[model samples]
Target: MEGFLIRAVVVGIGLWLASQIVPGVEFRSTESLIAAALLLGIVNAFVRPVLIILTLPIALVTLGFFLLVINGLMIELVAWFLKGFVVAGFWPAFFAAIVVGLTSWVMSGWIGGPPKGRIDVVTMRQTGPGRWE
Candidate 1:
């Protein structure tokens, strides 16, 4: 679908920015960047949830801050799965994951395919009466 491809491209750009901002996060070329994006998505979909569940106690204890470690581990896992992408060590992967998350957040704000300035909310009251209240 077009939406999926657009999200992939956004994620790829996030990965590219991560490589630029974080040392030891390296990609060989655009091809590798695309590959990394795919792998990252797959890894996030399949592995991240499991890891999050397993680390729930730590995450809860840290007020969800430990999600950053899980994110870094997912980045490292993607690098391990892909040949042309390399993450030198844990610290680099941690910082790279932070950059990737931040980039994706900013890009999503700009590129989200929603009607401009529209807000969707659910209310208990019906449309006509008491709607404003």
Candidate 2:
């Protein structure tokens, strides 16, 4: 779907930004960057929710900071799955996650999509006697 492709592109940009900003994160080529972005989305969609639910107690106890670790773990998992992507260690992955997250957040706002729960309204005024436009 169009929406998925848009998301993937946004995520790809984020990943590219991360690779530039985070020292230990690297992508061998554009294709690998694209693959990593798509796979990251898929991992977040399917694996992250389960991890969150299973670790709810720890997440609550840690005041939700554990989610950052989970994010790093997801990046590491993606690196493990893709030969062309490399994350040197947990610290780099953690910092890379932060960069990617911020990039995605900022880019999504600028990209001009219909955001969730947004509403549009139209109003009309009478132009002449018994006429409205």
Best by TM-score: 2
Once fitted onto the true fold, the runs of candidate 2 whose alpha carbons sit more than 4 angstroms away are 112-114, 118-133
For model 1, give the 10-residue run with minimal summed lDDT. 124-133
Candidate 1 per-residue lDDT, tens place, 20-103, comes to 888899998889899988888878888999999999999999999999999999989989988899999999999988988888
Error of 2 at 10 (Å): 1.3
lDDT at 7, model 1: 67
Residue pairs with backbone overlap in model 2? none
Cα TM-score per model: 0.82, 0.83
Q: How accurate is candidate 1 locally (lDDT)?
A: 0.87
TM-score of 2: 0.83
CA-lDDT, candidates in order: 0.87, 0.91
